[model samples]
Each structure stands twice: as structure tokens, then as C-alpha cells.
Target: MGINLQKGQKISLDKEAGGGLSHIVMGVGWDAATGKTGMLGGLFGGGGGNIDLDASCLMFDEQGNQTDAVWFRQLRSRDGSIQHTGDNLTGEGEGDDEQIKVDLSAVPANVKSLVFTVNNYTGQDFSKVANAFCRIVNGANDSEIARYDLSCQGSHNAMVMAKLYRHNNEWKMHAIGETGKGRTFEELLPQIKPHL
Candidate 1:
């Protein structure tokens, strides 16, 4: 089982995995909040409709400048170190709805951090999203290392979910469940700076 992380919590990937990790998969999942009790039903005049949430990875240098991004519009980063699987239109079935793959060793030397984010591209606030979560999986063995729940109900449409950063040549995961308003990752750049 993987550790359940709270907002602002940080964990060393090396220690959690028992050693260094070469490849990792960051998975994001969610389900549309159902019933009239849900925010969507109360606020948006609807209930149990599809929510299109997008998962993205933003790479940054030591200076906190965005170096590259891998998102729905751009499936792969410039250096090819990160790749987004695809976009999931409906917050539907089972496990992860979307995933981003990262090659830690292949990441450019200048890149110091990788920030993960989720945005409601369809503009539905998180109150309508249920069971939202982001998890880190050891790509080699398909074992989850850690997970952060993002099911907090709110009016915000985007969340700076978590980040993976280089520390002493090792990578660490930090949970930052900062909610904000944005339809895309680019709009959340300012909100992501302080955390880096």
C-alpha cells in the first residue's frame, strides 16, 4: 500500500521506493459528483453529468521558470522526458482517468522540478467532481508509492495537485492541494510559482 498524503506534505521518493527510481507514472482520477446533493446539481442546474478534467505536467528550472510542459494540447515535452497519456473527457469508470509518464533520469539537467496539475477544461467547479486523486506509481513494478486525495469540494476549477522536485540529486514528492480558477495549466502558472 502507498502512503496517503495530506496537503503540503512532502515525501522522498528514494526512501519510499527503497532506493532510486528511474521511471514513474503520475496518475489522476475522478468521478462526476452525482445526485441533487452535489454542487453541480445545486449550482449548475444539473446532476451526474460528465466532467472533463485534464492532467498536465509543468517542468521548471532551479529559478522557478517554466521550461516545458506536457498537457492535452502537447502530449510530449521538448526534451521528451515527460509524456501525457491522453485526455479523458468524462470523469468515468474505475481507476485513473489520465496519466503522465516521467523519465527522471532523462529529464534535462537544468530542470529542477516537475509540477502536476488538474484542470476542469469544461469549467465545472470541483464541487461537481468526486473522488479526485493523484498518485505516484513506480513504473518498473507498477506499485504505487504515494497518493494525494483532491476531493475537497470547492468552487475552484483547477488545482496545483503535487510536485516532484530534485533534491540532492534525488527526487521528492510534495503534495500541494492549492485550488484556484483556471481552465488550463498555463493560467495556473502564477499559482504554482510559490510552491516551487
Candidate 2:
């Protein structure tokens, strides 16, 4: 929906053309410096991880103002997304949960809307307390495309933004909810350039 792809431009999942790419997520909001600060599944080596819950996500438009258009969605499982809870933050979980999918039939039928974020995380000592989010389960029955929230302040690094599409017609989610005091992601790129 929020069209803008150039950082690698390769959008063909070619699974026989029903659609191509479909999964890629990167949420960074909770850092104490580097090493473990809190929660992330069983710990060390058990074969399953990711669960740094702090909770916070919002989207209101009957009167609430704080819009930031433009979007990003690299979710798969046929848009119902069902994998990669990797959660690495500063421990490096392979390209940080490499989420880069969008094969809604190659997404060029005049896309609609898509954007999300919660960019913050630095861990090593303390300062903790962060919130994160991710959801895109529509059609095939998973139906969820709206769990946006990016709480604000307490910077260790911030860039929490959100926006999803298909208003009145169907799907919806417009979030600027919070988080972007500018710290890393390159000073949150001028607060994400007015949501581009």
C-alpha cells in the first residue's frame, strides 16, 4: 500500500506466481548496553528464543492526531506470518531477524498502505522498559493487520513509528503512536521524514 522499494529492489517470490516474498521484521526497542538484560526464551541454547515483552501499541483516528504515512511489511506465512521470533537486538540474531517479504502477488497492483516500527534497543546494563509490536494476518483467516504501538521517550535509541492500510474498504491501522526522540537509526532520520 505504501509503495517505496529501492534498497535492494528484488520483489519476486515466484512460488509459481501466487505471490513472492512474504516475511521480514526488525524491532529494536530495549537495550541495556549489549548482553542480556531480560527475557528471550529459555536462555543460551535450548533451540527457541525471543520474548522481550514490555507492551505498548496504539492507533486512534476519531480525534487522535499524529499521522505518519508510508509503510513496510515483510511478513509471510501467507501474510498470516507464523515464524521468526528470533529476538536478537544487540546480541545479533543473524541480520536481526531478517524480515523482507512482500509477495502480495508481487505487490504492484498500485499498492495500498504498509509501515511499522518501534526502533529502540541498546542493552548491557540497565535503563530497560520498552514496548514492541508486529502483526499482519489478513485473508486466509488470520486477520490481524493492526497491532501497532511504538510508545515514546526514554531514549537509548528511538524510532517507533507505524502505519497500515485499507481504510473504510477493509484493513486499517495508522500509527505514529510514539517513540522517536532520535538516538540511533541515524537520529531516527529526522523523525522518519514526516512518515515519508
Candidate 3:
């Protein structure tokens, strides 16, 4: 079992992986928090449909500038080091709603940080969602590393959930859990820059 992290917490990935960590999967999971309907039809007044939450990663260099991004529209990064599993239209099932796989060893040397985010692509905010969480898993062994539960329910449409950054040549994970309003990663750039 891995540590259950809280907002603003930081954990050394190299220490947890015994300093040989090369690959990881950032998974975001959630379920619609509809009341009494037992379904997510017309819950937010947006429409009688499910929430479409998207998982995305923004790659940045040491200067904290965006070098590349991997999201629903662009499934892979320029260097093929990061890949998005695809968009999850409905926050259903028992596991992750979306997953972003990253090869740490393959990431360009200039790249220093990877910001993982979840956004409400359907314009519905998190107040209509529940059980939201972001977790890191060992891609090689299928073991979990750490998990941060997004327990805040509000009208925000997006979240700058967490990030994996380089420190002393080692990678560390930080639980940001900062809420924002955006339908895509492009709009959240301003909010994510501070954390980088």
C-alpha cells in the first residue's frame, strides 16, 4: 500500500520506487454526485447527460514554460514520452475515469515537470461530482504509489490536481488540489504556472 496524501503534501517518487522508477500512470477517478435521481440526467441543467472529465498533462522545462501537452485531443506528447488514455465521457465504473501514462526515463532532459490535471469538458462543475481522486501507480508492476482524494465539491470546472517534478535529479509528486474554471488545459495554463 502507498501513502494517502493530502492537499499540499509532497512525496519523493525516487525514494518510493527505490530510485529505479522509470514509468508511471497518473489515474483520475470520480463518479457523478447526483441527488436522488440515481442517475446523472439533467442534474446540472446542462443537459440530460453524463459528465465528461478529461485527464491531461502539461510538460514544462526548467524555466517553467510549457513545452508540450497531452490531452484528449492530442493523445501523445511530441517526444512520445507521455500519452493520455483518452477522454472519459461518463464518470462511471469502479476504477479510473482517465489515465495518463508517462515514461520518466524517456522524457527529455530539458523537461523538468509534468502537471497532471482534470477538467470538466462538459461545462459541468465539480459540485455535481463525487469520489474524485488522483493516484499514481507503478506502470511496471501495477502497484500504487500514492493517492490524493479531491474531496472538495464546488462550482469549479477544473482542477490542477497534482504534479511530478524534478528535484536533485529525482522526481517528486506534489498534491496541488487547486480548483479552477476551465473547459480545457489551455485555459488552465494561468492557474498551473504558479505551481510549476
Best by TM-score: 1
lDDT of each: 0.92, 0.33, 0.88
Superposed Cα deviation of residue 34, candidate 2 (Å): 14
In candidate 2, stretches whose alpha carbon ends up further than 4 angstroms from where it belongs are 1-57, 65-87, 95-115, 123-156, 172-179, 182-196
Off by over 4 Å in 3: 36-48
What is candidate 1's lDDT per residue for 73-96, written digit by digit as tens? 999999898999999999688999
lDDT of 2: 0.33
- Model 1 worst lDDT window (10 residues): 40-49
- The per-residue C-alpha lDDT of model 2 at residue 142 equals 30
What's model 2's lDDT at 118?
Answer: 43
TM-score of each: 0.94, 0.29, 0.93
Q: What's model 2's TM-score?
A: 0.29
lDDT of 3 by residue, 19-129 (tens): 689999999998887572544445555543588889899999989999999999999999999988988899889988899999999999999999988889988778778
Error of 1 at 27 (Å): 0.3
